[model samples]
Target: MSQSTYTVQGMTCGHCVQSVTEEVGALSGVSHVEVDLPTGLVTITSDSDLSEADVRTAVTEAGYQLAS
Candidate 1:
């Protein structure tokens, strides 16, 4: 499995974390997700080879911005 970390922005509370986490976790190959709302840090675990762009897109679609 491959793992990656993304710095997401605009996560102000638990609900934001849950929103991002659920969106990311729903993606194919995304086995797990850990989101730290205070730091806007998002970690993802996937068995398939998911690209960084895919991760970024997922975050974007979840109404958040991802650090470049």
Candidate 2:
């Protein structure tokens, strides 16, 4: 398995965490997703390493942005 952590901006509550988790978890090969609301950290585990573009798009679809 491959895992990566990303900082996401604009998440404020449990709903935000759920939204991000759902979106990112939907990506192909993604097996797990964990969000730390206080830290804006999202950790993703997958069958393979995920592309940044894919993660960015997922975050955007969840109504958030990935920290640059």
Candidate 3:
């Protein structure tokens, strides 16, 4: 499995986490998602390496932005 961590902006609560999780988790090969609310960190586990663009798109679709 492959794992990557990213920082996200505009996430302040459980609902935010859920939204991001749902969106990123829907990406192909994604196995798990963990969001750390306090730090705005999102960790994704996948079957293969995920493209940064794909993750950014997923995060955007979830109403958040990946920290640049």
Tell me the lDDT of candidate 3: 0.98
Worst 10 residues of 3 by lDDT: 8-17
RMSD of each: 0.9, 0.4, 0.4
Write down the RMSD of candidate 3 (Cα, Å). 0.4
Per-model TM values vs. the true structure:
0.91, 0.98, 0.98
- Per-residue lDDT over 1-68 for candidate 2, one digit per residue giving the tens place of the 0 to 100 score: 99999999999999999999999999999999999999999999999989999999999999999999
1-68: candidate 3 lDDT, tens digit per residue: 99999999999889999999999999999999999999999999999999999999999999999999
lDDT, residue 7, model 1: 97
Q: Which of 1 and 2 is ahead in lDDT?
A: 2
> Which residue runs does candidate 2 get wrong by more than 4 Å?
none
Consecutive 10-residue window with the lowest summed lDDT within model 2: 41-50
lDDT of 1 by residue, 23-67 (tens): 899899999999987889888989987887888888888899998
